[model samples]
Structure formats: structure tokens, C-alpha cells
Target: MSAPGPSESGSTTRRGAAFADIRRRQQATRGRGRRTRSLFGMMRPYRGRIAILLVALLVATAASLAPAPLAAKAVDDGLSKGNLDHLTVLVAVLLGVSLVGLVATVVRDRLVGWLGARLLSDLRERIFRHLLQMPVSYHERQRAGVLVSRMTNDVDALQTMISSSLVTLISSVLMLLGSIVILISLDLKLALITFTTIPVLLLGSLAFRLASVDAFARTRETIGAITAHLQETLSGVRVIRSYGREQGHLDRFHELGDENRRANMKTVYLNAAYFPAVEYLSTAAIVIVLLVGGAEAIDGAVTIGVLIGFVTALDNFFGPITELSNVYTTFQSGMAALEKIGALLDQESTLTDPAHPRELPDPLRGELRFEHVTFGYGVPSRGGSASAGGTGASSSPIVLHDIDLTIPAGATVALVGSTGAGKSTLVKLAARFIDPSEGRVLLDGVDLRDLRQRELRSRMGIVPQEGFLFSGTVAENIAFGRDGATREDVERVVASLGAGDVLDQLPQGLDTEVGERGGSLSAGQRQLVAFARALIAGAPANGDGRLGGPSILLLDEATANVDLRTERRIEEALELLLSDRTAIVIAHRLSTIRSADLIAVVEHGRICEAGTHEELLVRGGAYAKLHEDWQRGTTDAPSAAAS
Candidate 1:
């Protein structure tokens, strides 16, 4: 056929480019067989049901094939011979076969559909479980929309293969084999003539299969891209509207939509060409059969009944051939999806719990020590080699260098720093989010790494800068860490934290629903809720003394965003919470850190000065300068109390 018209030609060009990109990605995917095998292995648990479905398919194909031969016999013996009894018998048999085929098909389809849905559910659950186990870094790099698509679109593709393609492929093969054997038995010469077009049919199918792989891959990828774009745009819709970028975003969306449209059209074109080409080849086979059989019949080499049987079988053969070609496409799409999913499953976590981790001693005391700690955050070496820099040195040259510091149990240490001063990094080391590159973080004189991570973290309460909450009621958000807490338990924690007024202010009090990420609540409210959650979690679960209160409290910009009144209430609450806990508070506002027992002024990832709030003012150093700046910003005259 001639190439599509000019408008169509332009579309084809765009589609071709899209397909090329998809092909490049497919080529880059490693371990095709491993992925395919793993996907198949998932179905092994349901093998018995699959086998029953296959048996039903075979029976359906056989019953379907039976009617064709019976009709051919009726054509020659009843119509040509004018025999009524033979015609009636053959008609009845054909009707019975059709009924049997219908029943078998329905049973097979229902069974396979159930199997596919069950397998898909299992696969989704498995993936979700793995996702939960994955570290925070994995989520940091992945797009929400793309991950959602993998669970939905990719799994649905495999579902189609299992529900339809699996049975269809088996039945088609059986039907084709039955037709070929019967046709040759009826007339070898005509069968040979039909066989001549097999090579053409095979070549056309191979070409279509090869081209379709790229086309389908493009279609899948474009869908993911469009999904990701929509997710990102919708999440930031408020910003987009505020900045008057709606029209710009709409234009970009249209561009992505056009790309998706072109990809689908390409797949359509390939499918359109493939089916017609196969039909033409089948028609060619039929024409050859007719020419060779007609001559043989006239020369008295074959009977009319046998010739009719050959022609009838040819019709049956083409149906399976066409179906098989379609199944090939489904197989390829499923295989490609499996490969992507398997790669994700095969990835090993970079950080895992150690084997035989040391147990924590009873009645844990909060004596935190940093012993000659030198660390770098992930930084490139001068020679350009990539290094997993320790938390201390990762962000800049070194947040902490040769730092040896010890905090006595129940001491309040405040970390005061400007931006990029590594105050956050220092606290993260104590939390064990990342280990030190050199030296060690010791908790009660034991190496932090030697203790179980879960055991160590359980004794700590953190009020992060941005208080994150899940989709639930305000009460649930507060009681998140402690299990099986009663309503009274929740109310007590809220009252103690001075957040009871926050509950009363809400429309539904503690029962009010917090929208996703606590979007419904104000920033101050969210922070208070997080503080309540930490306090409740730190409290002993059972009256048994096994689990103690939080031995360490790490606050990073905890009150930075709260109002002055809320900050004061939080400070009052903190006085009670910090009485028996070792507290490390990271703050930018000098006012918040002024009452700290000891304040360390961090600059260039190092502590430039450290002393009590009053003594730091007397030192005439970085802390003194910062204190003077704070006084000037707050008051016209520096009061004696400030010194």
C-alpha cells in the first residue's frame, strides 16, 4: 500500500520517533529470561487451576473442529445426493457440538479470569510489601505516578495475557494441528498447495511482531509519562494558579497528550497492517487449494466429499493462524512489563539490619558521646571518584571535624547555627539515620552501631521541623506510635502537651479528620500533634519498667514556624518532657536557644563556640556577635540582662 497522506505522514514521523525511543529503552533492559521466568513462577501456586482451564480449552477446540467436518460431509452426501436422513443427522451433530463448545468456552473463560485476578492481587500485595520495606532514599528518587502506573497498567497487561492469551494460544495451536492432519488425509496434493503460503505467512508475522515490540513499549511509556505529568501538576495546582501558569501548564499537557496519541496511533497502524497481511496470505493459500483441488476433482483423482472436507478445513486453519498472531503481541507486551517489574524486585537494599545485633541493656541511661568523629556526607573526591560521604562531611567540606563531645544524662544541649552549619547532620548521627564515616557515636558508652537500630530508635522521640501526618483523625495522628491507646489515653497526652486548646479549636475536636499529609490542619497544629505523638510513644507502654520514657529528644526547627504564643506553650511543655531526657535542640532563632543549659554555635560545619547562655555572651566570639545581632533586631538598646 502507498504511504499515508501528508497529515498522516507527519503523525507517522512523530510515532516513529516515539517508537525508536521505546526500543532504545527496551534494548537497555537486562535479564529478559530471568524476568519472564520470575513472572511465570508467580503463577506456579495456581498451576492446578490453569491446567484445568487448558483442558477445557482443548475440549472446546476439538468440539469446534468436529462441526466443520460434519458439515462438509452433509454438503456432499445430503445436498449432492439428495439424502434427507443424512442431512438431519449431520445438522443435529453440528448443533450438539456447537452447544458443547459454547459451554466449554464459558467455563474456561471464567476460570482463567478468576485465576488472573487472584494472581494480580497477589502480585500487587507483594510489590506493596516490598515498597514498605524500602528505605526513604528509594521513595526520594521515584515518581508517585510512575510507581502507581506499574502497579495498575503493567499488572493489567499481564492480566490480559493470563486471562485470554494463555488459553487462546493453546487452543489455536491445537486447532491448527488438527486441521493440518485432517486436510492431508483428505487430499495430499491440495494440502501441499496450501502449505506453499506458510512461508509468506510466517515472514509477515515475524515482521509485525518485531515492529510491534517497539510500538507497544512506546505506548506503555507515553502512558506513564502522561500519568506522571498529571500527578505532578495536580499536586502543585495551587502554585500553578497563584503564578498564573494555568495556560502554560495546559499547553504542556496538550503536548504530552499529543505524544501519547501518536504512540497509540502507531500501535493501531501496526495492528491494522498485521491482520490484513495475514488474511491476504491465508487467502492466497485458499486460492491455491481451490485451483489444485478443482483439477483433481475433474480428473476423477478425488471425490467431491473429500474436496469439500479440504476446503472446510482450510477455513478452520486460518482462524487459529490469525488468533495466534494476536497472541504473539500480547505475549511480547507481558514479557516487557515483567522485565521492568523484576528489575525493581531484584534490587537489594543498601542499608539492612545487621546479623546478630547486640541487645540494649536494661534501664537505658541517655549518655550520648561523639568520640573524635570525622565524617563527610556523600561528596566527590578531588580525583572525581564518588564517595559515600558521612553525614558530617556530605553537605559541605565537613560539618563536624575531629569533634569530641559528651553530654551527661538528662542534660539539655542546644545547637545554634546559621544555614548550612550542619546542625541537622549532627542530630541525624545520634538518630543513626546515617553512620559516621570515621569514629563512633556512643549511646551510654556502647557503640551505637553495635545496638539494634529498632531498639535504639524506640527510646528516642523526635519533633521534626516539618511535622508530617497521615490521613486520619486528629486523635489517631497523635496516638500514631503507641498502639492500643484509649481515647482517655489520647486526651491525657494532648492535655499534658498543652495541645488540648488546639483540639477544642478544631471543628470536630479530636475526632476531626486530618486530610492527606495533614493538609487540613495549620502548621502549628501539625507540630503540636507530632509533639503529642512523640510524648505518648516515649511513655512506658505497659506499667512494667522494661520500656522507659524517651532518653533523648532531638528537635530540629521544632518551633520555627509556630506562633509566639504556641512557642511559649511548647516551651512550657518541653520543660516537663526534658526533665529526665537528654535533649538536643537545633534552632535558628537565638531566643529559643537562650535558656539552653549549653549552647554550641556552629559555623562552617564546626562548633566555633560553646558555653552556657550567659558565659557565651562573655566570651566575645561568634556566639557573642550572634547574641548582639539578636538584641539589636529585637530591641533598640542592649539590656544588661542580654549580657
Candidate 2:
């Protein structure tokens, strides 16, 4: 081709951009179609009730439409002809129609309410199950408030649509269509005149739709933001009050609330101007038809009864329109909510159980091995020498590099390093909380991925920095670690952990409620309970203290916050806890891990030293440096922090 001018180049570029935009829009449309199908597919199980609802709607609409014709018959065939008997018959038929309509409406409401409740329940369960299934990395990047919003605010929008707007939409369409046929059949001329206002209605709706294109979606978004803010505030109220930042948090919450209010107001503004105008137009159509029909009657071209019937039937046309207008808010919000919920449902977890999961070997040794593994959160990482940020296709820094290590069965391996040195990442790999990006983690001889997550988790127990307890008795919280664990089982596990004082300290012993997140108890108490919870799962079946349920125990060093006395008590419990179990502890204090079977010095996603603490001290490498720093800092040795 000859050298093209800048104008030609610009034009070609514009065309290409335009085509790309078209493709994006097409893709979005297809996505929405799929989401819509998924939303309705949730209702498939209740199709039988749906059929009954449909029948009720039809019956109700038919009964509702019968009245106008009956009035016309009474006027033309009964009143005008002076037949009282005929008028009486029409009146009785009218009463019968009202009764049928009443019954149908009741059935419709009952079924709609039932479906609304069922769908809302199912939607929450789906979101919750999927959310729990997601890998630790996915949760690490997402806000708790946003996920809570999906389960609460987004799902509630659909509830409003089901209970209110759904029936209106169906009934209005049927009524509108039914009215048109009756009006045309009654008086074609008058029906055509009444139809003249439809263009105005359509034009108004088009304008409203254009103005409110993304308004409903914006409303949903703002509400979710508000919910997120509120949730965070409530969760951190103690911190806020402690820091004297309650006013600041209140200001932030108000800002979010205002944003939500503004978003909702946009839709309100559109409806305020649009729906009333429709009502006025409906009234105008009535005036036009009545004026024309009166003249026709005076000219003897139409009967008075037909004129009356046309006016009464006029509502059938505008009534559905008004009903739809009334429920438009619910419709739009529900659709917006459906899209959000669908996106959540579409989140495919990388940590799902295998299609054909391998059975866990009986007498599992829990020998953990990481073989040349690599990992990233699929999350953008902060820059520096540590993260190796902007790596590969992900553009997110790798948190773990090619690593090979083995923790033999029934060994206590203490992970020691700096804050971002992939200490927690290693234990997480061993637990299979996340899959390795490049290589595999094996339990015994089998890849972790091959084992079902539930079975794997049941065999292993993790106790983090905070031992989060549910709102229940201390015994109940301990019982959660194992299935069908009785009150006796709970008491025995506590006694075995040497944590009997925790129950004695409680007013009701094991029956005393933990309160939300174990808030009713002290930090040390919570930690002791957590230890018991972990051990109760496959605890010593006999008095000999042999491992039963949980063979692998992951501890994040729960004694860091307590006093020396409590710390010593926890250390005593840890001794018993670590017996015959494969243990990986993220050691915060260097002194605690000196006696560990193995100590791995991790630095910037690589283990620089592996051996006993004494071996590393003799070698005089990275671990020696950490030990030196800890000795200088304090006797507690928190300066040797990991993760």
C-alpha cells in the first residue's frame, strides 16, 4: 500500500476502536443474558408452586376484567330495557367475579411470599458456601463488609422484587393485553382513540430508561459500600473508641450513607417526573375518549351503555401501567442485585476438591513436603527487593519462590524470619489452604490436591494468633472441632490439655457462653480453648495420649500477648499438644523454638537456613543474625518476628 496520510491512519484507528467497543458491549450483553438465566434457574425447584401462581394470576386477571362488561350489560340490557330480573342476574354475577378475584389474589400473594423466602434463603446459602470455598488469597484481597453486603443487601433486593414487583409485572402485562382485546371488541372507534396516548407513554419510558441507565446499579453499589463501612465500624468499635476516633468513623459512615442516599435519589427523581406524567396522560386519554363517546351517543352513532363500558374499561389499560410504575423501583433494584449475586456465584475457586479425590491413608503420618513450589495471591504486591513485584503474566509479585523442604512425620518445625519472609505461606501450603503456582505440596506420598479438602482439614488443625470462637458455650466451641463430640468428650479434652481452670473460672463451666468471638473470656483463656478445640479432633482415643483425629497441628504462637505466667502455662499446654503430631509453628519468639526439632530461616520467600537452632548458631548464618538481634532487643525475643 502507498503511504497513508495521518487522516487515513486516524480514521482506521477510530474504526478499530469502534469495533472493539462493539465487541465489548456484545460480550457484556451475553454475560447479562447468562446471569439472567442463572438468576431464574434458582426458581426451577419451585416450578410446581410457580405453575399454581400463574393459574392464580390468570384467574385473578380474568375475574378483574369481567366487571366492566357486566356494568355495560346492566346499563344496556337491564336498566335501559327496564328488566329488573336481568339487572339482578348481572349484579349476582358481578359479586361472584369479585369472590373469585379475592381468592385468586390471596393465593398469588401466599405463593409469592413463599418463593421470596425460599429464594432469599437459598441465595444466602450459595453465597456463604462459595465464599468459604475460596482460597485464603482470595479472602485476603476482599473486604469482609463487601461479602456481607452481597449476602444481605443484594439478596434483599431480590426479595423485594419477588414479594412485590414480580406479581405486578405478570398481572399488569396480562391485564393490559386483556383490556386491549375487550376495548377493541366493545367499541373499536373508542379503543383506537384511547390508544392515541400510548406513544407519549412509550416516549416517556424511553427517556426514563435512558436517564436511569446505570442508576439502579449505582444504588446497589453505594448501598454495598455503606454496608461495608457499617460492618467495619461495628467490628472495630473497640479500636475506634480506644483511639478516640469514634467521631472520625462516624463522619466516614455518614459520607457513605450520603452517597447511598444520593444514588437512590437519582432513581427517585426520574420516577417522580416520569410516572406522574404517565398518570396525567392516562387521565387525558380518558377525557378524550369520554368527550368523543358523548358526541357519538348524542348523534345516535353509539349507545350510552357502550360509552359507559369504554370508560370503565379505560382503567384496564392504564391500571397495569400504573401498577408497573409503582413497582419499577423493585424491578430495577432486583435486576441490579441479581447481576451482583450472579458475579459472586460465578467466582470459581481454585481450591475445590478433586473430581475423584484420593482416600487418606489410614494411620496417616502427616509427613509434609514442599517440592519446588511457587505462589502468588493473584494480587498486586507492594514494591521492593522482597516481593519481586510485577512478575510474569499476573503482574503480581510471587510470595514464594521455588522451594524444597520436608517436615518428617511427628516433628515440630519452627518457621523463623522477618515479617514478609513467607513463614505463614509455608504452613498454609502444608495445610493446603492454597495450591502452589508452580509445584506441588505432598502429605506423606500423596499430593495435597489429590486429597479432599474436608478430609484433609479434619486430619489437620490450625490455631491462629486469635482463637475466634462462635457465640456459644466453651464446650460447644471445643465440640466444633469434631463431629458428635459429647459434653463428656469436651470435658475430657479440656482436662487432658491441663486447661481445667478455664472451666472452673467460668460461672457455668462448659455451659457458660463464649459470647461472640469468645469476647467473654480473656486472651489467654481463648488461646487455651483454641488448643483444646484443635486437639479434640482425633484426640487420644485411649488414656495413653496417642494421636487420633488431627495428626497435623499448625500453631501461630498464641502466647505472645499474655503475661509470663500465662505464657508459661500455654507453653506447658503446647508440650502436650505437640506430642505425636506433625507440628508447624510460626515462632514469634526465638527462645521458644530453640528446642524445636527443626528451624528454617526464611528470608524473602526462600529458606536460607535449615537445621536445629544450635546447628544454625554454629553455622553463623541468617538464623545466627536473628538470634543476635533477639538477644540484644529483649529477653522475650519478639524481635525475631515471622509473618
Query: Which TM-score value belongs to model 1?
Result: 0.84
Q: State the weakest 10-residue window (summed lDDT) of model 1.
A: 383-392
lDDT of 1 at 556: 92
lDDT of 1: 0.78
RMSD of 1: 7.3
lDDT tens digits, residue span 1-643, model 2: 7988999999999999999988976875687789778868999999999999999999999999998888899999999999999999999999999999999999999999999999889889988988878777677767888889889888988899888898899999999999999899889999998888878777877788757757998998898898888888888888999999999988998998888899889998998998889899898999899899999999999888888888898999899988887787778888888888888787766666778899978888889998998878653222111111112355766789999999999999999999999988887878877677777889988998888988898888788888889998888998899988877777777877777875678888888898888889888888878877888886445566433548998887655655556666667766776767898988767866777899998999998889998899999999999999877776454633431
- Which regions in candidate 2 have their CA more than 4 angstroms from the true location? 1-28, 379-393, 543-549, 635-643
The CA lDDT of each predicted structure is: 0.78, 0.83
| Candidate 1 error regions (>4 Å) | 1-30, 72-99, 369-408, 435-456, 539-549, 601-611, 628-643
The positional error of residue 596 in candidate 1, measured at the CA in angstroms, is 3.7
lDDT of 1 by residue, 59-127 (tens): 898887886578668877888899999999999988888898999999888998898899889989988
